[model samples]
Target: MKKKNIIITGTSRGIGYELVSLCTDAGHNVLALSRDAAPVSGLDIDNCACFSCDITDKRDVAKVSEFIKEKWNHVDVLINNSGYLVNKPFSKLKMSDFQDSYEVNVFGAVAMTQVVLPFMKKSSHVVNISSMGGVQGSAKFPGLAAYSSSKGAIITLTEVLAEEYKETGPSFNALALGAVQTEMLEEAFPGYKAPLSAKEMASYIMDFSLTGQNYYNGKILEVSASTP
Candidate 1:
């Protein structure tokens, strides 16, 4: 496989971090984005570039866009992996929680996509990291309204963009992830058993992005330990 230029968001830790590692190991040039400090020791920065930017901030995202344009000129794959979650009962959920969740999961992803599209060449791939909770309503969890709703919007956005860009080159898909042992999942189901690890989830996402199958465009590629 050809080494592609890949940009993955929310790479401070969890699935995004694992994705960065897998992409780098596969010889792809990786551009990692996060608001937190850079990776301390584990990752190889030789072929990987880390950028500190808050995805929720449009200005920060734009700055990263400029940097990418100046450095790589074009990106081959874009993975929107940033997400936010606040767990509580519906009655206890605050309006601020919903606002924060949407800002990161929906608007932030959209903004980053908008900025990167201009610099993305033909045949580029865009993967949105959504959750299975977004696909089916969960009666078991009450406080997931904000998080799940935002992810649902991400799925819809993926569909709309896929249709809108059908004539264009970039293919768009949403990965409706199940219970992965990521920080977000831990926050969602505190003390609950995790069904999959971040490494496992990242492996699937990376493979899907590289294959360019286009079969899953505008559809959700649900992943779980049981599904694979």
Candidate 2:
């Protein structure tokens, strides 16, 4: 496997954290971005370095972009794994919820792509981590309207960006994932039994993040354990 320079957002915990673990273990150089101001406690891998940056903040994103340029000068893969979920029924959902969700789920990805595109080599892979709830006709949850909509936007953006950059390079794809046994999942659905663990999902994420451009550019790949 080619050792690549990878950047993953929201690497403080959950699947994002697992991705950092997998990448570092595989001897890949990783720039793990987290909203937390400090590096994840006890995460001391030589190949991995942690940076504090909230995806919603353009200045923070810019600094990260600058840091990447100064260090590796280019990225081989970028995994947009940061997400937000403000679960509330449509009637009770506030406008701020929609804005906040979009900021992280949609705009954050866009911002990262735009800032990093210049530093990304040709054929670089971009994996947009979306939720199954964003998929049309999928099983809907009661209080995930804003979260779902933001993710749905990610799918569209992935498709359009992939097509638009067909000749330019940097393949883009979105994985609409089912419930994973993550802290976020438990918070959203208390005591739910999710079929996939964070490390399991992280394994798939590593595969798609590195190699999916070969077979799945501009597509919304739904990853679920449920059988239709």
**What local distance difference test score does each model get?**
0.84, 0.88
| TM-score, prediction 2 | 0.96
Evaluate model 1: give its lDDT: 0.84
TM-score of each model, paired residue for residue? 0.93, 0.96
What lDDT tens digits, residue by residue, belong to model 1 across residues 1-228?
888999899988899989888998899998889887467124656888886889998878988777886889898999999989888888898889999999999999999999999877658999999988787543224678898889889999999998998887688999888778888778777786677789988999999988743566677777656432
Report the Cα RMSD per candidate. Answer: 2.1, 1.3
lDDT of candidate 2 vs native?
A: 0.88
lDDT of 2 at 28: 96
Worst 10-residue lDDT window, candidate 1 = 36-45
Task: After the best TM-score superposition of candidate 1, give how far the Cα of residue 60 lies from its true spot, in angstroms.
Answer: 0.9
**Tens-digit lDDT track for model 2 on 1-228?**
989999999888889999988999999999999898355535878888777888888889999877886889889999999988887879999899999999999999999999989887667999999989888888887899999989999999999999988897899999999988988888877988889999999999998888998887899999998642
